[model samples]
Target: MKLLLASSLALATVLGGGASAQTPPTRDPAQIQAGTYAVDPGHTQVGWRVSHMGFSNYAGGFSDVSGTLDLQPKTPATSKLSIKIPVASVTTTSDKLTGELKGDQWLDAGKFPEMTFVSTKVTPEGKDKAKVAGNLTLHGVTKPVTLDVTLVGAGVNPLNKKVTVGFEATGTLKRSEFGVKTYVPLIGDDLHLTIAGAFERQD
Candidate 1:
C-alpha cells in the first residue's frame, strides 16, 4: 500500500507541474498579430435563439462552419471577414424539431443549402471591441446586419502550437426580412444570433 501511494503521489505531481506550466491566452489587443487566418471549424460555432409561443426561448446551433479573416491589427478598419454556414448542419435538442426547421415550412434547407456573411465595414469600438457591418445572405435573401464583436483571446494553442485568436459576436434580425415568415408572431419573427469564432494564423 505504501508503494502504491508513492506512485500515485509522483503521478499527481507530474500532472500538476504540467498544468502549471501551460500558458494562458492574453486579452490585450496589442499582443495580437496581424495575418490572414482560416476558421478552425472544430472550434467555431454559430448559435441562435427564438421565442416559442411566448413561453420559452428555443435554442439551436450550426456546426461545420468555414470562414476567413484578414486581420490588420495596425489598421483595424482594413480587417475583413467572411463566413459560410451550412443550413443542413443546424441542430437542436429534439431531432424532430431540427428536421422540421430544415423543411420547406421553415428554413427550407434543401432549396438554400448555405447562409453566408461578408463584412463590408469594420468600426473599432474600443481597444478590444468592434462593430462589424456585413451583408448576410440566408434563404435566398440578402440583408445588411451589424454585429457587436469582442475579442476573446489571442495565444498559441498548446496542442497545435499555432497562433490563434477568438471572438464572440451577437446580433439580432427579423426572420420576416429574410423571407422566412412562417409562423410569424406565434413562432417569433425576431431571431438572435451568437457566434463563437476561432481562427488560426496561416503562413
Candidate 2:
C-alpha cells in the first residue's frame, strides 16, 4: 500500500509541473493593469530594412534596447512611452558593412552615441491597437514619426508572476530627413522599422 501511494504522489507532481510549465500568456486587454512598466531588454528587438541597389532588401537590427511605459488601459490616450537605443549596438550579417554604417559617413556612432524616441501623442485605434506619434532623434537630428502599434499579448508571467505586456509596431522613415544621407538612392532612402517591445509592470 505504501509503495502504490508513493508512486501516485510522484506521478501527480510530475504532471502538475508539466502543466504549469506550458502555460501561455493571455491576449485579453482587460487583463492589463494600469502601472509603470520597465522594458525587458533581453526580449526586445528593433529591426530595420532597406532596399540595396534595387537588388534585394538588406536588413539590420539593434539590440540592448531599453525603454519605459506608463500604461493606463482605461485611458490609453493618456499613456506615455520612451525608448533609448545605443547606436553602437546595431548589427548586420556583414562585419565590414556594419563597421562602415557606424562610421562618420553613415550613422556616425562616435558623434551620436544614442538614438531616442519620446511619445507626444497616443491614439487608440481599436480594442488592441493604437497610433503612436513621437519625436525620433537620430544622428543629432530630431523629426516627428508615427508608428502603428498592435498589442501582442498581456498577462502575468508564469515564472516571475509579473504583469507583462508585449507590442509590435511598424513605421517608415526617410534617412535623409535625419541627416544620414549616405548612399541615399543606392542604399535606399526609405527605411522600414519594426519593433518588438516587452514591458514588465513595476510595483
Candidate 3:
C-alpha cells in the first residue's frame, strides 16, 4: 500500500508539473495584433535640416503634428502610414528666421496651412528595415518621396503599461520642387528631413 501511494503521488506531481509547463504566458494584445497605432505626440518628433547660406545647415522642427499608422504584426510589409504637419508650427531658435521660413518665399504657412504624406507602398528591405514610398504634399505641390525607415522595436511602457513602437526615417526633398525656392544660389535646394516617431497602441 505504501509503495502504491508513493507511486500515485509521483504520477500526480508529474501531471501537475506538465500542466503548468503547458500553460501559455499572457501577452499584450497590442503586441499580438499590432494593429493600428497613433503617433504619441508627447513622445514623437519631426525635424528637418537644410542649408542656410551655402555655409552651414539650419535645423528646425514642427511642434504640432498628427498621424496614424496601420501595422500588421504578422506581415509588416503591408503596413501603412499617414501624417500631417501644420506649417505654422515650424519653429526655430531665432524668431526672425522662423518668421521668414513661414513667409511666401519659403513655406507660406498662411496659404498652405498643412503639409501631408500618404504612403503608396511599403517595401521591406530586411528584418527591420523598409522603404516607404509615398506622396508628400508641401507648399501646394505634391511629389513622390521615399523614406528609408528603420524599425526601432516595440515594448511596454512601465508607467502606463501601454505598448509602444518606435521608428526612424530619413529622406531628402527638393525645396524647389515644392515651390519653396527662396534663395537658390545662397542656400542649398535639398532639404533633409529626419523623422523619429513613437506610436502608442490604443484600444
In terms of lDDT, the best-performing candidate is 1
Off by over 4 Å in 1: 1-4
Overall lDDT per candidate, in order of appearance = 0.95, 0.93, 0.84
lDDT per residue as tens, model 3, 32-54: 44678888888777899888786
- Give each model a TM-score: 0.94, 0.91, 0.82
**Candidate topping TM-score:** 1
Per-residue lDDT for 1-203 in model 1, tens only?
99999999999999989778987898787788999999999999999999999999999999999999999877889999999999999999999999998999888999999999999999999888999999999999999999999999998998888999999999999999999998889998999999999999998
Per-residue lDDT of 127 in model 3? 68
Model 2 regions more than 4 Å off? 1-23
| Ten-residue region with minimum lDDT total, candidate 2 | 22-31
Query: What is the overall TM-score of model 3 with all chains considered together?
Result: 0.82
Worst 10 residues of 1 by lDDT: 22-31
Off by over 4 Å in 3: 1-33
